[model samples]
Target: MTDDLLLTGARVLDPGGGRSGRYDVAVRGGRIAAVGADLPHRDARHVVDLRGKLLTPGLVDLHTHVYAGATYWGIHPDPVAWYSGVTTWVDAGSAGAYSIEAFRRAIRDFRVRVPVLLNISAVGLTGRTGESRDLENCDVDLAVATVADNRDLVAGIKVRVDRETVGRHGTEPLRRGVEVAAACGLPVMVHIGTTPPRLADVLALLRPGDIVTHCASAIAAAADGGGPVSPALREAHAAGVLLDIGHGSGGFAFDVLEAQLAAGLTPYSVSSDLHARCLYGPAFDLPTTMAKLLAVGLTLDEVVAAATVRPARALRLPDGIGTLTPGAPADLAVFTVEDGPFELVDAHRQRRYAPRRLVNDATYVAGRLLPPRLPEPPRPWIPLTAAQRQALQRRAGTVRALLTAPLVGPEGLAEQFPRQQAAVPLDPAAAVREPVADPVSEEG
Candidate 1:
């Protein structure tokens, strides 16, 4: 242990301390051997002076995808995690019983620290539209068997119970999902949105330690046409169920988040839900996602807790990750807080307020900074003719239609149609867009 690495002059933020201090940390054999001032540097093999940087426990993104080509919907976890200051990332149901082994062979066995959440469905989100709905693929015995086989790597059970996937048998799938998870003595992570048997009924079935993701989603309108996070959410939280914010392409809702936050019901943890579909904007990576929550009243410590300790606990890897305790794995992140007018987006293709920029300066796993990855290539800024630009502007009036276009769905579209003009004031506002009679009605 004499030939160790020394990282000095860092503003270390220890969650356990609930305070930060300037200190040095020593790493030997992939474990943090010490943290103090004047650590012996004579026998050190490497010394990195991280001055003017904030050092914290490596980010732990509890919700992500890593199956690569297997799950066409997601990017490789190692590239996404390491490049964005996340050392540990849980693959949230990109594979299941049938494909879990292959996933391990291709992903988990690698040097990267990526864990998996076995999907309740065997194939695990196979085809985008309705593959998760096939009851045959969601065999309970099979899922349990898979978990038992890979208990060391399988954190919990994941099931998407949205309207498009679960249809009328929403509760049934969730019940079976719980049963399967119970067989392995593991918790179930249920994705709640848009289906039958309301949010309350579904949440009522969850127990302590079980996870409810997408809790703050604008799906499954209430009797009053509101989002989930209903009275049942309060009941479930009181009972110790964890509310995980899986802010995916279609799950994050500003109104729901604000309502819940105002009601003193913040998410227990925040997850990237990093998939190919939504990675373009709003949900680029985990740090950006965390910054979004940090914008809306959460302290830096509180936001860090959501990405670290809370998520680690939810994954049942509390000891292995989410902290910088002595002898713990040397997973760490360095970040810089930049000022002013930072933009954050939600899953609803909506923008929100952010005052500080949470930029990932660097990331390390077991004391080794993974190779830097290049930033994504900027989109081609097509120089449209004046006529074309005018046409695009005209098309902007039909926002609903433009939103349906494949390219316009992501944040990139906003660049094409900048909000330059303010609408004129109206007496009551309802008279601004008066409804015109149909051609047939007018003729009559």
Candidate 2:
């Protein structure tokens, strides 16, 4: 194929500059040749019209599981990546030291850019059981050796810190993981859920550049007393800890996310923790997760930054990978922002209607056009099973009584649902303040 290709008449969205306007982007020798209005058509060997579409840098999903044949939770990367406008997919702790070689062998032929976070546990996500439950699986020396051996492929270390995964180990596993990360000179991506170590303790062990995935989880007794954004979380963010939306099954809660957004604790990166269970619903793909964020309150530019530029920076990938500037890699995605009365559901099954949602139109990787996948029929919300419905009915009875009682305003909200009120911003601008220095520049 010829090296020259041109995309004309599209609204180019540059999240880095916070700008969007009609322009043409030229590609040659697998890099952006030029981006401007009305470049001479004669300079291009081939051209495609993208009228009425939005073009931006190809997306990067920092947290995903694409070790496919090697791990239990793995899913193939290409189907979810290129088709959904993602050119780079970072596998989050799907394969540990023991299985990483096999994982590497399996993905040798894949076209998408795949970097991995080595799991702290040697076995990784081998089975249904938690990788860290045994503690012995967390072999630090072995992890260091593996990272040293696979420097090019391994971006960081990953550890899941939760009640089910780490159990009574509390913060011990996290400390061990952090040690290994320090030894290898890499960052650690910690998965947070219902905690025994408590979110504060986990944050304490983490250095400035480390990542906290699933920051919006709504399981019982969250870090900030079940509030959307906790004071400790704000402190962690201020201290330079990066938060990610690892929207996995049971990870994202609409109520929790809304409160966090309102409080100004926006995520540093947006990723779909796309695994076997979540790939079909809730967290369908990176674009779907981006759409959910847009539905909540983020502008299109903000959402694109979370998916593209921010992720590339967080992963410490080369600078040009997530930008559309001249001489950068010609990885681009086109999307259509459709008006919607669309029902968007979170991990908790709480539903919201969005007036607009983003849909993928086309994708280009390395200046080569990739075939688009047929759109999956929309399945907004999963059907509630009988047992779940029955339980909800019981809870509804309790809520019904409260609703019938005299309604109070803000005080009543704070009294009945203190977590939500606690998440509300006291100073809206301060709550949503940007970090003083770029968190992406810090070393692990």
Candidate 3:
């Protein structure tokens, strides 16, 4: 008897259909066999009722750094996957040629499905900023050799040319990185924040199928308070270059993003640069980031597509890791349509506070259901531990001070309504300082 499970009475939210309704889905041999209102359960194994929950396809986080031990920026992937319901994640340039094997044998081999983008820098992002300046580390031959050696695990190449980071090497390093990746016939994923030469110049190097992450990020001269995305960006997009939202710590700029969105530029894929420094706040998890987009005018279907099928297509994963269609892996996520007052931020220091945030209920991967735990009850008012007492005293003092003080201007309040603050006079000088400026265009 084949062991199987049935999930029924749930409102399925399918990206392909963009609709929600009661449905039944069946899982057998770690794959979804059927989905509808009534699925046969004769000679079955187990059945679970899913009432009042929204069922969606399992999420795929495309731009993550899961180097584990190779780099400080790398993080263990399983916790983010199982806990957060991400079944497929693409490691956005964590390890280089020298250290990729260890990553494959120790990490990728153990996990289910985690493809990697080999960093163009031969040594990868080790130590700190200038570590990339070491010429030997960025050996093109070594990177090509490594990618050729591990064709099964490596997806493409990654390069960073941030202004404060890559320094003088600039376009030369990027050109070399592309050369190695081109030899291997894989797309290149470039991290654009502080790179030299210029954003337009770097963007000009990317060809169709190649990826440009942090398209709305506040890069070297691409800061929100700067200027507009160079004509090169528009041309690249027109030429089929995929733009990814690598919403990491210093990647997404709210101001630049607003401008880009208003300019009619939309991202092809939405991904979180999920890592230690980024996973906590604005980029809590892929789902949260998707919810933020939903708040920012992306339809539910558009948001889901960017995070799932669109990314799966970009990665060229023919097995179909994005949809919930029959014969696909039984990966799914269940959430509640929560009404919440939430706050979101971008690479720029701007904040978007919304009245709602998606709250996860349960997640399923390969027929295994992992439900989120209920929040723990507050501790009884007992003698506090040293750490707890210190926290409580600080909170108490802050609250008492707030209570005693008179309500001043809107600036004094933590979360004041927009109407409370007086608008500042528009300044022509500020316009000149728009963070994101005209990026370098190989043309000029």
Candidate 4:
């Protein structure tokens, strides 16, 4: 039997390992076997020619909401992963101690890897906001126990400190979440926006390894919504806090990103805060989000690192997560670099253009190519323009027509069962014989 799958002739880019250039990758037994020049494909079961394509580690989204069916923000990752090249979907704060078992049950069916930053609020994001309003829901001891119970799934703790989510409670929720993190020895991922607790106050609570998910959010940029970045944000960047682009429906803006970039405060990771609301526009997918960084003048290598290696290291996801190195899981993405003065938009509809973008050609998880899946329509609560709604309806219609239509014309199909072998004799009365049924011999 053939033992390997060889992929050749791609501009291999492994930003995590600092390896880039013309390279061929080999996969054997669902793990990367080798990566170098002239890999022999003679004995490989499958060999794909990937000339003029860009190959990199399967993307790891540091922030996303994938606890589908149970959470207000949840959207299944598999539907997007097959087409978007995101292999690791980090479900950020979609579930908490109260709903973790259900979250686990939901994720059990996912094809991609899903690690969670359990929410500080026991209710999780079952609603759009107010999860942290009730202080009783923010029980620290219970959270620590929940993490203990689900140690393998829980990577860190998440707290949403905002006007709507925390109400008058302010950063008290953030403090409790920090306590939980301190006990668990896990980093806290704080969602910063809509200050009652100022952005400065929020940044102050975060330690070196903790993360600020929507660091480029216009909602928290400054009081006036545009200008120089606050000194607090600069201090946090200097103090080693990781800035992640959680480009959700309302979580990002070009002005803020540009300001941060100009201030030498590059995002440590790039993640599509993909959910029911943002899945369609603004934050379509991780690659699109990466392209926005490119539009902002970041090199492909830097953007790739932010999407892959940097996030993987920040989260300490398993060793092989964001690389194509030998012995790592053979999870990878292949893309065609398309020339495009592509119109890009941030969470607020701020516009920019990218000269080139990565269009996904294939996504593989553990050496097996993932099958296509269409995403569901937006949830009822999600606000969309009439044009956007029309587009979705049109898309649904097209998909329905495509699926309902015959897969091929007569010329495109071949018959597997021929008439000659299955035909009954015309002169059955004259020469009919019964065939024996076997049950080791004849049925008794």
The clash count for each model shown is: 0, 0, 18, 0
Off by over 4 Å in 1: 1-3, 16-19, 108-111, 220-229, 374-444
lDDT for 168 in candidate 3 is: 72
For 1-444, candidate 1 gives per-residue lDDT tens digits of: 584688888888767435478888888888788888778888689998888888888888888876766665656666565668888878888887888878888874444677788888887865664546668877888887888889788988888777777765667777888898777778888887665657777887788999988777776434314444466778989898988788877777777788889988889999888876656655779888887887787787788888877788787785558777778788888878777667777877677777775677778889888774433322233223476457546645576465566864476555566678778787776777778779998888
Q: Look at candidate 4 and tell me the lDDT of residue 240.
A: 96
Q: Which 10-residue window of candidate 2 scores lowest in summed lDDT?
A: 373-382
Winner by lDDT between candidate 4 and candidate 3: 4
Model 4 weakest 10-residue run by lDDT: 219-228
lDDT of 3 by residue, 1-444 (tens): 443988888888776434457888888888887888877767358887788777777777879977755576666666566556677788877788777878887663434468888887767766445545666678888888898889888888888767655677777677877898789888888877764567777878888988988887766434422465667777888899998888877777666666677777788888999876665445768877776676677776687788777887787765557777888788887777666556777655577754555566666778887543322222232223476557657766886798788879777767646657987888989888858655586447
Clashing pairs in 2: none
TM-score of candidate 3 relative to the true fold: 0.78
Strongest candidate by TM-score: 4
In order of lDDT, best first, we have 4, 2, 1, 3
- lDDT value for candidate 3? 0.73
All candidates: TM-score: 0.81, 0.81, 0.78, 0.93
Ten contiguous residues minimizing lDDT sum, candidate 1: 374-383
TM-score of 2: 0.81
